[model samples]
Target: MPARAHKRFVLSDQPKKPVATAGGTFRGDAASFYLPDFCDSRAAFAIVLIAELTAIVLSIARQSAAVGFWGELARAALFLLWVGLVSAALLCWLRPRLARLGVGPGSVAALALLTLVVAAISACVSLLGHSRLVASAGTGAYFPRQLWPFVARNTVIGFVISAVALRYFYVTYQWRRNIEMRAAARVHALQARIRPHFLFNSMNTIASLTRSDPALAEQAVQDLADLFRASLSDRHQTITLAEELSIARTYQRVEQLRLGERLRVHWDVRGLPPDARVPGLMLQPLLENAIYHGIEPRPQGGTVTVTGERTAQLISLVVRNPLGERQAEREGNRVALANIRERLALLYGARALVKAGRFDEEYIVTLRFPYIASAPPAGGTRPAHAAPGSPEQ
Candidate 1:
C-alpha cells in the first residue's frame, strides 16, 4: 500500500538553523553542575533508606537494655526520616537554580542547604526534649546544662553525615558523567567515519552530473547540503519521525541521481506516527548502507524496502534489500550495523533493539525503540516543502 505522508516532515522541511559548536560546550557545563534529580521516586526512596539505616546504626551504638532504649530508637528513626524528606524536597526545588551556578558554588550551596535543614530539625527536637525534662524535674536548671550539648552533638553528627553523603553523590555524578561523555565521543567518532565516504561520493556524483544535467545536478547539490546539515546537528536530540524519513529520502534521491533507475526504494511507513521523536539521522544511514553494500556492487541494482509500524509502547522499522554476493558484504556493512546498534543502545538503554540477518533471499535489518511523542509544531506552523498528502518520495 502507498504510504500516507504526515505533516511532520513537511514541517521540518526548513531545518532549524545550524547551531554553533559552542552550544555543546555550554550544555556540558550546565549538565555537569546539575544535582541529582531528588524529585525522582527512586532517588527519594534511596535517600529515605540511607537515612533510616544511619539512624538505626547510631541508635544501636547507644543501645541499652532499658525499655526507654526502644523509645530512643523510634525517635531517632522519625527524626532522620523527617530530615531526609525535607532535604530531598528542598534540593529538588533548588536543582534548576543550582545548575546555573559554577560547579564549586553549586556544591557549596547544596551542602549549605543540607546542613541547615539537619541543624534546624535537630534544634527543634532538642528544645522539645529539654522543655519536657525541665517540666518533669520542676527545675529550669537542666535547660542550660543539657540543651546546648544535645543540639551541638546532633548538629555535628548531621553535618558529618551530610558531608559524607554529598561526597559520595559527587563521586557518583562524576563517574556517570564520564561514562556518558565516553559514549557520546564514541558515537561522534562512528558518525565521523561515515561522513567522509558520503561526502566524497556525493561530491563526485554532483561533479559528474554538472555537464550533462545542470538542473538535476543543482538539485543533487541541494540534497547533499541537506544531508550534511542534518549530519552536523546534535545527535543526542531527537527529530520528528517524518523529519528522519525525509532525511532518508534525501539520501535515497542523491543515490538515485548517481545510480539512476538501479537504486529503487519502496516505503511502507503509513503505520508510523509522523510526530514521534526519533534520533536524528537515524534512518538515512541504513539506506546509505543498503545502497553502498547491497545495490552498488551488482551490475543490476535491487530495491530497498522500508516498512514501519508502531505499537502502544514501541516503534519498529524494517529495511530489506536483496542480498548481495558474500564478497560484497564487506567491512562497510559490519561497521554500519555496529554503529547503529551502539547508538540505539546508548539512546534507549535496554529498550532499543537492532536485528540484522538474511531472511529468505533478502537481507533485513529491523530496529525497535520506545515510542516518544513530540510536541506540536510551535506557532501552529512549521516549514513545509510539500502538502500533508504528498507522496514521501
Candidate 2:
C-alpha cells in the first residue's frame, strides 16, 4: 500500500518537472555570436518550410497499420509547426539579451528553451483531451500513464535537434565572417594601389609646373591638397556621386596645370542622381587612366568627356577620351579598369557592371551600378556578403 501511494506521489511530481526545471532565462548584449534572426520574414518562411518537411518525414518513418496516415501527418505537422513557431517567437524575443551570454552559454540556453517549449506543448496536448494525438496507441484510460513518457521523449528529441541546429548556425556564421574579411582586405589593397599611382602622377604634374610657372604650381598644390583631404576625411567604402564628381574635377584641375591646351574635359552628368552612392575614389582613377593613355601621348590635346544618366534600375556612367592615332600609345594598361571591376564586385556583387575598350575613335569605359539613395538610417540595409545571425551595426 505504501509503494502504491509512493508511485502515485512520483507520478504527480513528474508533470511539474517539464516546465519548472527546464532552465532559467538568460540576458546579453549584441556583441556575442548568437542565433539567426527568427523575426525576419524570410527566416520565418524557411522555418515553416523545414518544419513541414520534417513532419512529412516523421509521418512516413513512423508508419503504423492502426494509424490513419493522413490524420497522423496532419497532427504531426500541427504539433511541429506549433512548436517551431512558438520556439521562434520566444527566441526572437530573447536573442538580443542572449547575445550577452557568449556563444557557449547562449547555445545551451537556446537548446534548453527549445526543449521546454516542446515538453510544454506535448504536456498540454496530452492533458487537454488530445492524448490520442501524443500516445497514438494508448486508450483514454491509459493516457494518464503515457503522458509523462511522451513529454520526456519529446524533450530529449528537441534537445538533440536544437543542439545540431545551433552548431550549424555557428559554423555558417564563421564561414561568412571569413569571406567578408577576405573581401574587405582585398578591397583595401586595391584602393591602396590607386593612391600611390595617383600621388606619383600628381607630384610629377606639380613638379613640371614649379620650373615654368611658380603660381600655377602653387594652385596645383592646393588642388592636390584638397583632393587628398577629401579622400582621407571620409572613411566609408562608398560616397555620393556628387562627392566623387567633385574629386574628379579636382583631379582635372591638377592635370590641366600640366597639360594646358592638351587636356580638355566636358561634363554631361545632369541626368544623374547626384545623391547616388558609389565607391570612393572610383572616378579619379578612370580619368587618370584616360589622360595617361589617350590625351598625354598625342601632340594635339584631346577632350575627355564624362556622361552619366540614371535609369529605372541602374545608374550609368561613361568616360570617353579621343584615341591617339598611334594604336600602341592609345592601348590602356588596364590596371585601373581591373581594380575598379574588383572593387565593384566586392561591394555590389553581380549588380555592378564595368566594360572598358575601344568604341569608334574613342577609348571608352562604361560603368553601371544599382541606384543607391543618399545615406540611410543606421543599420538600415545589409551589405553584400553580410554574415547571418548578426544585425548590421
Alpha carbon lDDT of each predicted model: 0.70, 0.70
How close to the true structure is residue 51 of candidate 1, measured as C-alpha lDDT? 77
Q: Provide the lowest-lDDT 10-residue window in model 2.
A: 16-25
Residue-wise lDDT of candidate 2 within 1-393, one digit each (tens)?
Answer: 223322332332222122110011212456335478888999889889988999899989876555567766777888889999999999889987677666667778888899899999989877954545545755443233467888999889998998899878876765565466455545654454435656887799878879998898898899888887766754346777777888888888887876789999998877776667787877887888788778987899899999887778688889999886675732234555655655664455445667777878998888888877667548865232211211111
TM-score of each: 0.54, 0.49
Q: With candidate 2 superimposed using the best TM-score fit, by how many Å does residue 302's alpha carbon deviate from the native?
A: 1.7
Off by over 4 Å in 2: 1-174, 177-201, 204-214, 230-236, 324-333, 376-393
- Tens-place lDDT per residue, model 1, 78-163, is 88899999999998888878877755677788888888887888787667656766578764432224656766776787788778
Where does candidate 1 clash, by residue pair? none
